[model samples]
Target: MTPQEALFKYTLRLGDNALIQGHRLSEWCSKGPILEEDLALTNIALDNIGLAQAFLKYAADIEGKGKTEDDLAYKRPERQFYNHQITELPIGDFAVTIAKQLLISAFEVPLFSALSHSTDETIAGIAAKGVKESRYHFVHSRDWCYRLGEGTELSHSKLQQAIHDLWAYTGELFEMAEEDTILLVAGIAVDLEELRPLWKETVATVLTEATIQIPEDGTMHTGSRNGVHTEHLGHILAEMQYLQRAYPDATW
Candidate 1:
């Protein structure tokens, strides 16, 4: 792919990840363990949605299409989306959500940090803002990991199971594709491979503090970078795009 095409896909990938993740988090509205956490999770969902808008808007602009961010997000087919598979998984128990958040936010912190220096001014500007938000996300989830991982036996067992279930998917977070290679050469993409070590360190520190044992590495789940995803993505698209699909021309 040419640099332009690569950049568009890269931006769309970022936007897709945020949008789906935000949707999952939004499901926790009024469902958090406490009032404070209910508000906190929703607030974080808003943050991810805002990030999605910025990135998808930029992607639309890059494509030079009249399409808006809403068009890309709500009108696209499931197979056309390029979000990480992990982001679209059904949010399980509170512990599962926390585990996914911890892993994702840990990766985002370094990814956004590196992107903050991207040669593309718009991407760099967005990344500079994103890095700050991701840090907060990391800390919030990390604290929860400690709380649940070291809590009562039931809580600890659930948290450990969540970690094990999600560990395999973590490798896809650092997967590089043709678009990534193209943008990396143009100085517009962060080298995800380089971020892997840092992400592992961050995860290790949090798990260690929580007294959680890290799962032994084996086969890692892959694919998402090429528009391949779990079956959950179709379900997400069905619910998310329902209104738009039902009335294509309707506008607020």
Candidate 2:
């Protein structure tokens, strides 16, 4: 891919991750375990959605197609999306949701921190905001992990089960795509491989303090960087793209 194409894809991937993750978190809107926690998740969802908009808008600009961020977000097909597969998985239960947040936010903290210094000005600006938000997200998820992991027999079991179920997907978060290699050379993309060590340390620290056992790494799930994903992504796209697909050109 040309540098321009690589850059566009890179930006789109960032937007995809945020958009799908924001959608998943938004599902917790009224379903949170408590009212305060419910509002907190909703606010985080909004933060991610806003981040999505920023990234997607930048992606569209890079593409130079005159397509708006909404079009890119609401019009893309499933196979064209590049979100990490973990973001598309079902939010199982409170423990599972918290576990997912803990793992993803742990990765994001280091990922965004490094990206905040990207050579690409727009991406650096976006990542700067992402660093602050991701840090908060990490703290929130880390606290929940402790509460759930040490709270009760059932809670601990559920959290552990969640971790085991999701661990394989985490490997994909650090996988490098072709665009990543190109951007890595240009200093426009954060080195995902470099972020893995810190991510593992963050996750291990939290899980250990919560008395949760980290699962052994097995055959790792992969492919989102190539637009391949679990069946879950199609379902998410079906709901998310419904309005735009069904009512083309219609506006409020």
Candidate 3:
């Protein structure tokens, strides 16, 4: 692919990750364990969605398309979305959600930190903003991992199971595509492989503090980078795109 195509896909990938993960977090809106936690998750959701808008708008500009961020987000089919599979997984339980967030936030902290210095001005600007938000998210998830993993026996058990179940999906986060390689050479994208060691170290440190045993790495799940995802993304789009699909061009 050309540099322009790679840049567009790279931007869209970032936007999709933020948008899908934000939608998952928003599901906890009123369902959080307490009022403060409820507000916290929703606020994070808003932050991610806002970030998604920035990335998607940049992607649209890069594509030289008239599409708005809303059009790209609401009109894309499941196979067209490039979000990591982990982000699209259902928010199963409180412990599971925390586990997912812990892994994702840890990855984002370093990934965005590097991207903040990208040669691409727009990507660097977005990453500069993203680094701050992602750091907060990482801290929040890390603290909760400590709490849930060391609390009651039941809580500890749930946290352990969640980690075990989610471990395989973590590998997919670092899976690079041809677009990523192009952008890497152009200094427009982080080398995800470089982020893996840092991500593992951060995760291992947090898990140790949480008194949770790190699961052994096994066969890894992947394919989202290639526009393939688990069944969960279909459900996400069905709900997210309902209004846009039903109303056609209706706008308030």
Candidate 4:
């Protein structure tokens, strides 16, 4: 693919990951185990949604197409997205959702760190701003992880289960797709393969600090990079896309 095409594709993948995960987190709004945690998750959810919107808009501009961010986000079919499966997995419990956020934010910190220096100026700019958001996300989630993991035996057990269950999905975040090859070769995208070691270390450190154990299941759950999403994404899209689908072209 050409450089423009590569950049747009790469950025859209980033946007999709955040948008879908943001929608998933919003499902917990007003429903978290506590009011503070509820607002915290919602804040993170809004942050992800805002960042996704910016990334999608940047992608659209880079593509030089008339397609707006809303069009790309709301009108697209499930198969068109290229986010990793980690983002779409269910938010099982409070600890589980926090675990998901921790895993995702750990990967994103270094990923966006590298992307901020991308040869593509738009990607670099987006990444530069996003690094701050990703940092804060990890900090917030990490604190929650610690509280739950180190609090009580019951809390520790729940967090440990959450960590073990979600660990498999984390493997796919740094698994680069063929589409990534196009952008990486053109200097517009960082290689996901190279990000793996860093991602693992960060994840390992956070879990360790939280007093959580890493499972050795020796298995990885994959298949979201190609837009084959979990059952959760379809329901998310159904709700997220409802207004758009119900009133095509309707605006506030």
Candidate 5:
């Protein structure tokens, strides 16, 4: 793929990941375990969606296509979305939800940090702005990971389960896909295979600090970069695509 194409694909994945996760996070709008947590999750959800919109806009521009962000977001089928399986998983309990958020944002920080220096002007610009937001999201999610993992015995156990249950899906986070190859060749993306050790180190340290045990020997599940998504994405799309589906030309 050409540099332009590679950059476009990379950015869209970034956008789709953020958007779908934001949508899932929104489910906590009124149902959080506490008022502060409800507000915090809501804030993070809004931030993620805002970042997605910025990324989607830039991605569409790079594609040189007239498709709007909504078209890519609402009109695309499940298999076309490039988000990892973990992002599409149900929020489950508050602890699990926060745990996944921490994991994703942790991965995102380094990815965006690296992207901030891309040769592609548009991609770099987006990443420069995005890295800051990602940093904030990382901090927020990590704090909760620590709180839940280090708190009462029940919180610690639940947090540990959340980490292990989600660990298999994490293999998808560091594997380079066609998209990664394309972008890395173009000087517009990180070499994800190289990010694995850092990812493991940072995640393990955070888990250690939280008093959560890292999963050592679980089978590593994969297949997100190729657009193979989990079952939850279908359900997520059912809700996300509803307005556009119900009224093809509907506008807000």
Candidate 6:
């Protein structure tokens, strides 16, 4: 693929991850454990959505297809989406949500930090802005991991199980594709393989502090990069695209 094509696909991958994960977190809008926590999750959701808009707008511009960010987000079929499978999974319980957030945020923190220096100006700018937000996301999720993991017997057990269930999906976060390799050689994308060791260190430190054992690595679930996803993504698209699909061009 051409560098432009690689960059466009890379941008879409970044935006889709934020868009889908934001929607999942928005599911907790009024369902957080407490009012403050509820607002926190909602605010984080907004952050992700805002990030999505930035990346997708740039992607649309790169594609020269005249598609707006909304079109790319709400009009795409499920197979066209490129978000990580972990991002689209059902939120499950509170512990599960935190587990997902912890895993994703940890990756983004370092990923964006490196991307801030990307040879592509737009990507660098977006990463610079995103680094701060992702850091907060990492901290928030990490704190909660500790809170639940060390709190009570039930809380500890649930958090541990959440970690166990989510571990299989973490490997995909570091899985590189040809598009990624292209950008990597051009200095326009992160080397996810490099980020993996740092991500593991950050997560392992937190898990140790929480007195939680890291699950043994098993077969890693993947395919999101190639547009294959868990069954959950279809449901996400059905709901997220409903308004646009049902009433094209209708506006407030």
For model 5, how does the per-residue alpha-carbon lDDT over 103-218 read when each residue is reduced to its tens digit?
A: 89888888888888988777788778878987888888788888888789998888899988998889888878677887787687888888778878888889889988888746
TM-score of each: 0.99, 0.99, 0.99, 0.94, 0.94, 0.99
Off by over 4 Å in 5: 1-4
Native-vs-model 4 lDDT?
A: 0.85
Q: Candidate 1 — what's its lDDT?
A: 0.93
* Alpha-carbon local distance difference test for all models: 0.93, 0.92, 0.93, 0.85, 0.85, 0.94
Candidate 6: global Cα-lDDT? Answer: 0.94
Off by over 4 Å in 1: none
lDDT of 3: 0.93
**Candidate achieving higher TM-score, 1 or 4:** 1
Put down candidate 4 lDDT per residue, 130-185, tens digits, no spaces. Answer: 88888999998888888998899988999999888887787788777766888887
Where is model 2 more than 4 Å wrong at Cα? none
Error of 3 at 95 (Å): 0.5
- Looking at candidate 6, what is the lDDT of residue 11? 97
Q: Write one digit per residue (lDDT tens) for candidate 2, span 111-164.
A: 888888899999999999998998888899999999999999999999999999
TM-score result, candidate 1: 0.99
Worst 10 residues of 6 by lDDT: 243-252
Of 5 and 6, the candidate ranking higher by TM-score: 6
lDDT of 1 at 250: 77
